[model samples]
Target: MNIMKRFLKYTALTVMILIIWVAAIFISMDKGWWHTPFTQDKMPNEFIASVQEELQNEFVGTMAIALFKGGKLAEESFYSNDKPADRNTVFQVASLSKFVSAIGVMKLVEDGKLNLDAPVSRYLTRWRLPHSDFDNTKVTVRRLLSHTAGLTDGLGYAGFKNPKDVQSLEASLNKAIDADPGSDGRILIGVEPGSEWRYSGGGFTVLQLMVEEVSGQSFDSYMQSEIFEPLQMHSSFYQWDENFQDRLCDFYETDGSKAAQRYYTAQAASALYTSLADLEKLFHLFDEDNVNQKPVSPEFQKLMWQVEAETLGTPIYGLGTFLYTELENGGFVIGHDGKNNPPINTAFRYNPVAKDGIIMLTTGSTNFATRIASDWVFLQTGKVDALLFTMQQGKMIQIMAIGSFFILILVASIAFVRRTGK
Candidate 1:
């Protein structure tokens, strides 16, 4: 009898703890713990409701949407994770790392420790730009930011399988520079600098080395001190830790895992974990004054915003961000898309004029997902897509809802039976 009683007691305790845990997640998600003061959530309640309903039907495993106006986060909501993803849900934001890393480099520029026009060799003493007939000296910092440094995005770093897969920064850079000319390892200034636009992930890796050399701190430490911490992006991180592992959402390709289980040594170019709430603040910077006194003057910021590349009298790439001065429909966009490692798709599309933007993070990547994103972009331009407000319950939602339903059933059944009837 005592054993039976103990069993019931322990079981009740376990269930109660789980209920508390789930409720905490729900509350934190509904009302975020970390955020900036808001004017209004950019998206209206009706709009959020409509989208939230539709998100349950989407293909992505986990996702969140944040809307901001003139630098204040207006509305934010997350939908359906295999694990309930609240505001703290973290997704590996692939090349988005470049966007953040560039901020670090710009901080160095603000400190007068680096120059945008200076050759990378000036700071990255460990490994210089590889020899090509192209003048390495022209491979300046500005060119790297704009991806116009005549460099090709070589076979970028392999996703590390484990700690063994990681390599020292010096060794990795040196290998790239020292590889045989025709070998797959070599990354050189393949074209004349200032010739054309080429998206080079490798270029950001170079910037990573440059930042480390100039700051005299590990790349992670430098970013923490300069960008992440001051900005209060508390959960944003480059390397894996227990907290990250607990909050990490799963990623999916069409049929398999698109995200690598291992980490990358190229921390600057890729490898960051963050959330929509945190990212909303990062995107806010494009629209608001740097409240943190980010050292750079307003004029210098204007320089960063200036499009470095041009065609037919139109501007293209801004510093680390892209500049869409004019769209085909006569609208404008000035943000970047990061389709880093597979299955993890993230984006920040800010409308400078409206001082509003979409901060999207998703752990699902597929051809259909791309189409959905396009529809979303068009929707921003006032094109109507039927996606918002429709509920297409994903697996996670069905399971969580079903379990909650069972719990409700148990409670109701217990409450209805009188002691005499029992």
Candidate 2:
């Protein structure tokens, strides 16, 4: 009996040591001091499997990932045991739509139809922003695209199932611009526009109005002609088309409940349905533009990569994308992340120097997509940024550590009691 107790005691001690070691590792990883080294050569499939396992264990509903090599689509995979999610499944890439919106705006600018520094009032003839004490003239297209337009957030109208249920740009502005006439929350121009950075989903909606007015075409039609159709990005559409309905991925909420058939109407800000394979076509434009193919102007493309604005405690905003500083040569990783509903998380990051990138889309709310993108960025650059992983679960990890320690203590106590009784 004593020998048996000794064995358990040793086992319990080993368990306790392991718990502490794991706790230390997690803490170190959170603090950006540790990482699971990954190979850059071919994208370690084992690491991806591990990430997928971790995501599944955490109850993430679905995942799709694609990697680009030499600025071309190289590898792609899908993960979801609960439902049908595959390589071509279209996901509502929320804020990622903003990048496309910016691209459309830039295309017009390249043709001299729109001016960046000009006041948005030049084109938004259908509707106008409400009057405020702040100078509205400073609210230029450049500020709006860069998120420094100083406009307040609009009423979020993203989850309505019927595309028609989504309000029109004129309606969104009328409601968001004032109280009683529109929404509960009115968009406020609190500060001088262009003087500082502020994120306004409403600003993009406002741009939708400008796109229509200036081009004499519907916002969706303009994008189709100028960007998507020209680039052969057949799978991307700004609104819900019957053709994409069958290809849409199921969205899951944070509680792991499947989202009902919902469609977002914020066409400029969040209402884009696309697959990773389709997005590669859009990314290829950036690559060709980098080499001066003039799909868009070289000057405008260069500006897309330049740092435009940044807020305190957040990544730098470059045009419609966030600037990632993780890559080694100190170049830049350009892309955007999107969340349509709580459970829908997507990340797309691109490297300019090597023209390589990775796209991640998931129906999990954990922001696991960022971690996956960060891992690739790290492997490419040999430098890490933003912890790359482990930033979102500090409390859960701590609880796990403490719980494991207590379990170890309970086992040791049981062994001690057994030995004494014998």
Candidate 3:
């Protein structure tokens, strides 16, 4: 008699608890206590799996990827766990910093503190390139940002020791250009600016100089204050500052084996550390319509992607960013790629048209081999998740709705019975 009574009482209590849960859910959902969602209605699955396989086969290092569509996070993937490359892992973003740095300079332009057409020599009291009778005359902040300054690419990973190489910017700028005067006529005219586009790391370095001179802040400090902090890019940094060492993953070669060094990393050209999550915030700026409101005006961010030049009748590059159009679908995208060292290869690309983008971060032993891996990540983005995210999202919503609905009814019935009878 005692055991039967105990069992009945416990079962009643359990049922009552479940009924309350369901009632609360139904009430909350119906009363607008819960947010109504606009269903995504689409997902792509086959493409996602293929992308993962491609990444495993091609890129030999740890990797993470995320895709956003219509201004919402659509998909994310991680390939390894020892280093555990995730949205929060920061990779040295290399020349991508040029795009970021340029945004700061352009913001200054918008504020009327700097003129794009003004000769950079006007601001530099610390050092000035000897005005070549021809070459240096055309150099201006605008040309430099657009890589039209005619300055040749100088150091790759070969030039710097680490981010702390304390050499004055002037010393680095004085390195000789390999191109002869007038070798490229448009860039050679010592007349005025806005001539032609040439890929110049030296040009970006010049912009860094300009930012320092005008802001009255060190390059790293200025970027932190103006760009990274504002964007909440907590994982991004310019130099290998001591504080960031722990967050920094060891870079690798292509073999997925041993580590690589800082010199092999793209320092000025490619020396930036950032996580995938932060990179998404940076790329989402390209969206004219944004879910996050603090971003710069879409018009201005779009200006970053605008083609700044055409060479040999084809667009070579845009302002501080690479320009590429997909041939199969004619989709247009703009972004950048880098590996701090070849072993730790990284690439980031975003389609402004599709409002879709991806980033791959890897660390390993061989630089060249890592690039082969990097290419696979890029290919995976357009190939895989592009098609699979839709199916997965739809399935998720259906499961949640059915589960929620059942719980709502059971809880509501219990609540009504308790109020009426007890």
Candidate 4:
């Protein structure tokens, strides 16, 4: 009985310690204890130097960065190997394609060719979402843009090394020809529409089909004519052009090895090629005062900023872009980040009210651009954004290790109690 009592006491102690440890971690994260606060007074040169220092690490092969202040380019730089990289250096901007694709959809809406609330099936004749248990009619363009659509194909397209291997849009839709493993490649409604927030690249691919059918042009051609050309984003394209070869930066792996160049048929979801100079033009789209040649009307742009979906009690997504962090003035920092396998990461974030933002693109480094962008937000706002929390793999691993230690202690105590009782 005495041995059993001792075991219970040890077990209780272990449980208490585990609970306390978890509480501490949550508290620390809430307080932003892991982050070093950035002061607004810091000089741009200092920030540049810090970023340059980080770039010296082996994980990064090339990076293009720009800082915007008062809706104007304050500073910009390009870092790379012996290759010639400059403001015109083009990058395959992974999921940032979604931001531009969303704009294309809204342009169609502005033209009265598409309706946000209408059934997406109304727009597409090339393909249809596979039949499922859910109400397919409820799957609307707005829900798909906001990722609240019922589609369950959580696709992340893996571009092909050879252009010949690229699947037709309809064929790829039937089975994501190069999606990441574990994702259901077949595009279909899996849940009740407007039920919850779920990230689905497959949803955007459907929008691509809608754009092509309604515009009576290829997705790339439609985006170029309706969006990129009007913005004077001369170097941005949904599909690769032979003319861009000289400007395209080679992608690389995390281990500093070169990765094969890839091509994509899922242009809306994963195939935007852009330059820093061109992306700067995109940043101005959020600037309400710069209305000379806006892509969408102020009213539609405002609609895009309005919250559409949330995760973990925080409103994290707006119409087609990410609602990153809220400002004290009740405005939000908005942008998007993109990641592709074999190490390419890109991020762009800005506070529209403050007119301050960061644009970062990297090759041979996974999530490095996002971390830096998150840090910039933390410095400006003193609050950690949702993306920062997702990047805390190291902290999570430490917590898991500590919890495992406590569990082992409890197990050992139970063994001791049993042996003594015997």
Candidate 4 lDDT by residue in tens digits, 1-422: 98678778777877777777777776577557877733343455667678887777557877999998878888898888646688899998899889878988999899898899999999888898788898888999999999999888989898898998999999999997798888857887888899899899999999999999999999999989988888999999988899989889978888887888889988999999999999999889878888758877778876777899988678889878898888887879998999997688999998988899999998989888998888888887877787887677577668767776867776687777777789
Candidate 2 off by > 4 Å: 1-31, 34-44, 154-157, 176-184, 289-294, 313-315, 326-330, 382-422
Q: How do all models score by TM-score? A: 0.71, 0.77, 0.67, 0.90
lDDT at 72, model 2? 67
Worst 10 residues of 4 by lDDT: 37-46
Ranking by lDDT: 4, 2, 1, 3
Backbone clashes in model 4, listed as residue pairs: none
lDDT of 1 by residue, 1-422 (tens): 96577557655855785586556544433232321221222244545665566555556667777766666677777765466777788887777677778777888887799999998888877877777898898999999988889987453454565776577766665554322234365466788998987777778878888888898987888887788877788888877666677787777654444454547767877777787667876775555464654433455555666767764345667777766434454445666656644566677666666666667777765322333333344444442111211112243355456666676666545544632375
Better of 1 and 2 by lDDT: 2
1 against 4, candidate with superior TM-score:
4
Deviation in angstroms for 59 in model 1?
2.4
TM-score of 4: 0.90
Model 1 residue 40 CA deviation (Å) reads: 21
In candidate 2, what are the lDDT values of residues 306-399, reduced to their tens digit? 7778544445677776787634565578888776555667888888888888888887565667766777777776545443543535754685
> In candidate 3, which residue ranges exceed 4 Å CA deviation?
1-45, 133-135, 159-166, 176-195, 260-268, 291-295, 326-331, 365-422
lDDT of 3: 0.57
What residue runs in model 4 are displaced by over 4 Å at the alpha carbon?
1-24, 37-41, 400-422
Worst lDDT 10-window in candidate 3: 382-391
lDDT over C-alpha atoms for residue 142 of model 3: 71
- What is the alpha-carbon lDDT for the whole of candidate 2? 0.73
Q: Give a tens-digit lDDT track for model 3, residues 301-365.
A: 66666677665454546667665433245433666655344555555667665565555565652
